[model samples]
Target: MDKHIWEEFVELERNPKQIERCEKNAEYRSMQTIRHTLGRCSYSNKQYKLDEESNVKVVPKATTDKWLMGHQRPDGSVHPSAIEAHKKVLEAKEKNKGKGLSSDDHLVSPELEEVFPCKRKDIIRGYSSTMSKKQCEMAAVASAALQNRDTDHEERMQAIESTMGIVVGKMASFQTLLGMLGGKVDSVIQMMIANAAAQGPISTPSPEKGSTTYPAGVHSRVMETEDSAPCTLDVGQPVQLLDNVGKVVALGSIVAGVTVHGRKVKPNERKVYIEQVYDQKALVWDAPQGDGYVVLSQLSLPTWLIWAEDRLVGLLNS
Candidate 1:
């Protein structure tokens, strides 16, 4: 956090509400300092009943940080999900293999932003007295515009997870969705596959694009390359689909290819296609909106739309 902001956090004297807030802010700052400076949480000093062997940092459930989700620790941090939290919650995963341990029990680091949530650029913009009326209004409007989008994202992700189950299960609904459009999206899918096949093996999720776009909860079934860490796009910002988007497009292409081939897509075939998809460079651009989303440039069937699995999906009709 900036020095000025830290000072402001220290000096907020108003009514009961303001005083209460100031106390919380000070506590948050103290926690952050201990976590970073000591390389562990203050709570980690004591022995817990759960894991007596290893003393690990524990993020307690506090009313103050209820809204704090794991976005910042995402840089090389283990995902909270059972699948990705490869590091065992206990001593080590390998030591207790086949114990049927549940996912949530794993010990993961608490997400700590370099700045406190109140001190973040977006949230602070509204609270800052220095901002003009127009700036605050614009910020509010942007927030309002995000509501429907956030809802859609949550719904789509839920549906996607339910459909894909565990790892890569048969997306029968996506297959059915494929048939509903008939031949509408075949060309696009075909072109994407041909391009990927042409390029052969390449790195996935190039760093210039910063950290993985996948949220903490998601089990990123998509392949990740050795050196390619996705860009750290801020929350609610436009997704950068132009970069490292081949794998998502490839998922759609393989399913669509089954429709063209007149046979049920096999599981092994799906795995092969998915693994190879990330090895090639992606050609993920050229939408009229210029946001790198997958929207059909042509208007063959106005009623239906082509949607990419992991990336942004835009609708175009002309």
Candidate 2:
């Protein structure tokens, strides 16, 4: 019997007009009771009702009238909350009216006036020559204050840019030094290997099985090689996706499976490969496309790659 009822429901759902008619009927039935007693707030258009306890409560559209008050015409008054807020504002103004000008109302300081050089004629022309003394004073003060604020803001911005320039210069110098050292070391190693080969089949000692040497140069070489190689993504490799870091969870012939920003990849979506990785958390590339697909050749090395390489070099050197 349940199966029969479910089949009937499925049939009804498959017919768009039938489904829409049923929805309309259901909505009408739901609103029938509410249309009888409750009302809507004139200000908010939200439904309200006077419960049996004689207190007003917000309710759904199916349980309220068109207006909160029972009267045919709305008085255009504010909501209770707005009324209370207005009252508070008026009270505050009344309390502060007798107080003298506060700090914010004061004219610009003497030192700032010298820097800003307010023109009395400009202020008078800004409004009118017959302007009150207080009005003229306020205008001059405001103009001076605006000028001071703009000047301060520009100085602060210049200082920040100068500081950033210094930091960037230092970083570039450090990177240049590292590159020179790496090139020298690589040349020395290559020369030693060449000389060893010239001496006739001498066996060279290799680093331990799990140990690595000169990881910074090695990483650079690996990245170069990978850039030219075919895309080889596998499950569990960390990928920088468009919005978040995610691990490759599945592989497909045409599409590679990946979770993006912690969201599971849905079936039938095209997967685009960014790159292969040894570490699951390597920040090597910018995030892939938001839909998990991207043009492979268009990607560039991420900004974090240099920092990662430096860190690896530090660890290897230590």
Candidate 3:
């Protein structure tokens, strides 16, 4: 997934003409667009110059980088491929329940079985039998209500599950919409910028509220490689994505945000309304509530459009 995503990103640079237009306005923000599309971010190389900014290197995402690996919820943690391996093993185990296993017993991915084991007993078992306490409380209340209405336990549970499924499905759809909406907003901004460029140079207004500036020449390469950039992203402010994997994780291949002074993400704050770094403000989503949104920097707009269009933006869920 990560490799394919990088291919999608690299497709932008396939058209040299797009980056060419950007060089005309090789201001820091303009140049940042190139970095953004390459899936680079600011603060990564605070001390370093733009040229030294790190790249994801357009390779298969490293195992360490994949978010699912060592997924640590209260229940437990699992390796990146553990879940799939476990599911496959469970399927094979159940399917062969009465049969004498032969070649069929080797159905589990050998690599995964080495760690997770094919037997159910040997498999890592941290599946939570109950939902979160809050959810369980809600369930208990629903059960009582249904009991009052003379519904059987099974019927009450089914009713609750069905209703929760519907709500969750809608939420998921809304999130997908936000991801697509972010793409649309970016396209519209790019269209405006392109139109402006066709007529004349698009002036980059001074940052209405100041943004973080680089210190000395060629900021430290260490900062770029390490994710410890000292910045916080807040609401209603613009942000450049530092890592492509983040969008892939948060938005699930989401093309994705911060606000107070308009830079740096606040601790534990995941959602922020995305704003164009060039434009004053825009309405899109009423309010941004998820990381599935990506607001492209105006400069990266042209290069990204090629990739975006290639993404078959039209086929995206309406």
Q: What is the lDDT of residue 11 in candidate 2?
A: 88
For model 2, the local distance difference test gives 0.36
Candidate 3 on 162-225: residue-level lDDT in tens? 9999999999999999897997889999999887667652221323322223322312211222
TM-score result, candidate 3: 0.13
Model 2: how far is 42 from its true place, Å?
32
Error of 3 at 302 (Å): 64
* Worst-scoring 10-residue span by lDDT in model 2: 306-315
lDDT of 1 by residue, 1-318 (tens): 576986676655545789888787776554331112213422233213212432432222321121121211323242242222222222333233456533234222122111123333433211122232233233223322233346668899999888769445456666788898868788789989998778554332453533344432231444343433243222222221223333343321222333212333332222111211222344423322223334433222211222232343211111
TM-score of each: 0.15, 0.21, 0.13
Model 1: CA > 4 A from native: 1-126, 166-318
Q: Candidate 3 — worst ten consecutive residues by lDDT sum?
A: 306-315
Predict model 1's lDDT versus the native.
0.34
What overall lDDT, based on C-alpha atoms, would model 3 receive against the true structure? 0.33
Model 2: colliding residue pairs:
38-64, 38-65, 39-65, 40-67, 40-68, 241-287, 241-288
